[model samples]
Target: MTTITRRTVEYPADGLTMVGHLALPSGHDRRPAVLLGPEGTGISDLQRRRADALAELGYVAFAFDIHGGRWFSDPEEMLARCLPLLADPDRLREIGTAARDVVLAEDRTDPERIAAIGYGTGGAVALELGRAGVPLQAIGTINGLITGRPGEAAHIRCPVWAGVGSEDPIQPAAQRDAFAAEMQGAGVDWRLTIYGGAGHAFHHPLDELPDQVLLPGVGYHEKHAARAWRDVLGLLGECLPSSN
Candidate 1:
């Protein structure tokens, strides 16, 4: 197994202390980097693990944080905090940019070979960064909010890959159609995948949250999760190749 290093990184954004998990592969050579965003509940161990996995795959991954250092198990609590942030695109840009600065400042990161990937609300931030004209090689989102403002997608400078559950109420057909239409209108290279037999947050493992509420249409599907991960890695390989 390839050795990797992990560290907690603290940053600032929107008057909150954002704490992210940064993972680096064991090498001196600069490596391609990814900025990872978490679900609306905030940065959890799940996203941290994804950072480690990306590091093992030879990329520097920083699991960017939102909600300061807190995570919500209650949907109401999460929505209360996330809804307002989601509504303001400039605020979202601040959050994504703050976390992104941390990753880019890393000595081991290849500044030109960077990407963004996010899940749920985090995914929305990734899109925000892209639409804000961030120079990323690719953007990969799963179960993310794909809604965009008018003419904003024209700034996207790289490919985008989005994966969502077929029955995801949070990202129903209307949202998907709107996302696609925007991408097409902007002449952006994008693809969307609808995993069959899956619902919202289907990639999430069983809830380990202490006060977890079992929400409808938000269950795990192991097979689809794996498939989506593979698709994400594929996007990275195709965009920011290892040999870069």
Candidate 2:
């Protein structure tokens, strides 16, 4: 295994002090980078581990934070904070851009070769970045099929891959179709994968979370989670291969 360095980075975003996790491969040379976004509950060890895993693959990865540095264990609180943020594209772009800038500031990052992968609310943020015309090599989202404003998708220059549970009530078929229509109309290279028998947040692990934190129609599917990770890796490998 390659040695990697990990650190906590602090920055200001959305009227709060944001704390993000940064992981870098063991080398002084610049490498492709990924901006990782977490679920609405905020940053967790799961996201940090993902950053480390990306670093092992020879890419700098930064797990960006939402909800400041606080993890919302209360379902209502989480929804209250995330729902509004999801509805506002400008706000989402502000936050996602903040994280992107932080990763770009790192000496190990190849600014021209960065991508974004986000889950749930984080996925929406990644989409927002693409919609805002941020220069990204690729965009991948799991259980976050949120669409953007009219004609905004035309600004996305990178290929997009989204994965979601077929039975996800939070993002039903209508929403998925709308997202597809938007991407198609904008001529963006995009694809969607529907995992059968899974529900919202299927890619998110719930074992370490509190019982009360499980929102309605949300459950983790271990098989699909692993599959989603593989799919994400494939997307990254295809769109932003490591220089090493």
Candidate 3:
């Protein structure tokens, strides 16, 4: 069984104590570390579960909180807290760096074998970390928007894999195509996987409520989620290894 521990780390930004769940591999030392960025709603049970799953795969995973203790009952409230952070690109980069610091400080964590994975708004934060030249082994995003703007794809020193829904209204085919072009132009090892028939937030199984921003009729696709999970693990395995 994977061993998991919940802890709190203070971010210099706003001096806020963000609660995090750390998962460690059983009977392992100096394992790779992963900084997991939660969805816009903050760190939930699902995110914790993902961290545990990562630990089971032999990595020390830390899931950081963006909203502290605040969780929104409505989508608007979530957006209210997440949108401003997204709009200010600098803050987004700070959040990712703060989370990375927390994970790297652990004695058992391998600093050179670190990665960042995010969902939705958190995904954008991960992308910003890559854009800011954070020395991460890999970066992954789930159903996140990657605005194809100049200087966005450049400076990514690591491989990036973005999982998006082909039917996601927020991120259409054109946007994904543009992002791919930018990554290729930047000479970054990047890949985008489009899941057909899935809508936005395809990895969020609990997003069944009636939210205008996210379709209430749309729900998580289990098959696609499983596939994405495997793909993420493969990416991490390639980017973060004990030997490397």
Candidate 4:
């Protein structure tokens, strides 16, 4: 097993002191970096574990925060903070860019090689970064199929891959269609995978978060979660292969 080192990083974004988790691989040489965005509820240990897993795979991984250092156990509170933020693309871009900068500042990160992968509202932030013309090697979103402003997606410079549950009410079929149309109209390289019978946030294991509210259409499927991780790995490998 590769030796992985982890630490907590503090930075500012949108008037909040954002706390992020950074994971470094075994070596000192610069490697491809991934800016990971957490779900709408906020940064959790789950996101940190994902970053560590990426480090074990030889990538400099930074799991960035969306809700400072807070985690919302109430659905209404989470929505109160995220709903407005989600409607504003510029704000999302600002948050995502802050996280990206954190990854870039790391000594082990390759300045020219980076990707953005996010979940839920965080996924939307990743897409916003792409639309803002940030040079990301790849963009991957899980359960965040959001459509951007008119003609903005044309600025995206790399392939985008999204995973969602087929029965996700939060990201229904119509929203998915609109997202697809935007990508297609912009001539951007994009792909979508709908996990059959799954629901929103299918990639997240709620069992690990016993206090979390069980929102409608939000459940976890172990099989699909594993598959989604594999698909994301494929996207990263295809777009930004990290050197061992």
Candidate 5:
């Protein structure tokens, strides 16, 4: 196993100091990198572990923070902040760009090889990065924002992979259809995977079971989460091959 170094990374976003975590693999090789986005609750231990896992896979991974340096355990508090942020495109752009710049400036990141994979609000940020015309190798989101802004999705120039639960209350059938239609019209190479019987934020298994039930239509399915991770890794392999 390669030694992975997890470090603290703080940057400015949302009028606050956002603290992210960077995981670098042991070696001098400038590997491909991934900008990981956390769920609305903010950067928790689960996200840090995710960055560590990505580093173990030999990719320079940085888990971006959502709500500054603080994490909200209360669902209402989280929603109060996340719901509003999700509605604003400019705010998402500012947050996503800060994290992208942080990873791009890292010594171990291959400038030409970068991808963004996020969950919920983080995933929307990833999509925003692509919509903002940033040339990303790939974009993967698990239960993230599926809808695109008017005439903005045309700027996305890379492949996008979005996974959602069929029973996800937040992402209804209408929204899914609209997102796919727009991506198709824009000619973006995008694929949407609907996991049967799953709900929102299904990729996170490390979260407590009690809290999972608290969030309506948000549950953890080990099988689906594993499958989603595999899909995300496959997308990265297809777009940003580690050999390159």
Candidate 6:
């Protein structure tokens, strides 16, 4: 039987209480914890499902909400809510730090084995956390963009795995190549997997229109989504130690 628990945490930052979902693996001691960041839509059912799936894999997972528990169906609203925080570097750091602390505070979580994974805007936060010298075992970003320039790449101290879709217009091939070069030049352990036919939010089937962000001739591919998911799980297992 798989054990999973869900609870809300109030992250007191900047005088606001940001609610988050914490999922723990039952019958485990000091398991590695993963900080799960939501996409631009905040903490949706999909994010919660991901956390539960991680818990089933024997990981304590925290799906942290940067959007203060609000959900929006409109793309414009999602962008409006997420863009301001992404634009402000300081707030972004504060929120990330707060979420990291929340996961670390759990007794069942292994302090030294914490990793972070995010999608889209949340992916930027995960990358920023690693770049800001946060003590993380690994960082994974899916269909996300890097906010700052490439100069800060030297500060990353852990392995990074980035999954991007070839059809993702938000992240152009040239930019991804530049980012990979920067990571390599900084001597950072990094790997980037580009899905040849996938578009943005490839893993998220719940999106009203997954192919809406597709280019004039590009669209999402299901095969790439499966491949990316497998790669992410393998990378996380490699970076984070098992409780057993």
Write candidate 6's Cα lDDT for 1-244 as tens digits: 5867888898875347788889988884789989888777677777888888888888999888877777666667777777787777667778788999999899998888889999877788888888788899999988776745566778889999999888777788887987788788888899898888777777766454442343232344668867877887887889985543
Quote the lDDT for 175 in model 3: 76
Better of 1 and 6 by lDDT: 1
> Which regions in candidate 3 have their CA more than 4 angstroms from the true location?
4-15, 207-218, 242-244
Query: Local error of candidate 6 at 121, Å?
Result: 1.0
Better candidate by lDDT, 4 or 6: 4
Q: Write the per-residue lDDT of candidate 1 for residues 1-244, one digit (tens) a residue.
A: 7899999999999899989999999889999999999988889888899899999989999999989999888888888999898898899899999988998899999999999999998999999999999999999989985677899999999999999998888888998898888899999999999999899888778855656775678888999999998998899999987752
Per-residue lDDT for 1-244 in model 2, tens only?
A: 9999999999999999999999999979999999999988899999999999999999999999988998988989999999999999999999999999999899988889999999999999999999999999999999889999999999999999999999899999999999999999999999999999999988767776855467778998999989999999999999999855
Winner on TM-score (3 vs 5)? 5
Candidate 3 backbone collisions, by pair: none
- Tell me the lDDT of model 5 at 172: 79
Report the CA-based lDDT of candidate 3 relative to the real structure: 0.78
Across 63-173, the per-residue lDDT of candidate 4 in tens digits comes to: 999888999999999999999999999999999999999998898899999999999999999999999999999999999999999999999999999999999999999
Per-residue lDDT value at 184 in model 3 = 89
Candidate 5 lDDT over 98-213, as tens digits, reads 99899989999999899999998899999999999988999998888557688899999899999899999988788789888988898999999999989987877644534432
CA displacement after TM-score superposition, residue 158 of candidate 3 (Å): 1.0
What's the lDDT of the predicted structure labeled candidate 2?
0.93
- In model 5, the Cα lDDT at residue 26 comes to 82
Q: If the candidates were sorted by their TM-score against the true structure, best first, what order would they fall in?
A: 4, 2, 1, 5, 6, 3
Q: Tell me, by TM-score, which candidate is best.
A: 4
| Candidate structures ordered by lDDT, highest first | 4, 2, 1, 5, 6, 3
Shift of residue 44 alpha carbon in model 1, Å: 1.1
Superposition error at 129 for model 2 (Å): 0.6
Write one digit per residue (lDDT tens) for candidate 3, span 1-244. 6455545555554246667777777664788888888777778778888888887777888887777656566777877887788778888888788788888888878788889998887788898888888888899998766663487678889999999887887778887887788888999998888888888777777554333355453468888888888888888878786343
For each candidate in turn, give its C-alpha RMSD to the true structure in angstroms: 1.2, 0.9, 2.8, 0.7, 1.7, 2.8
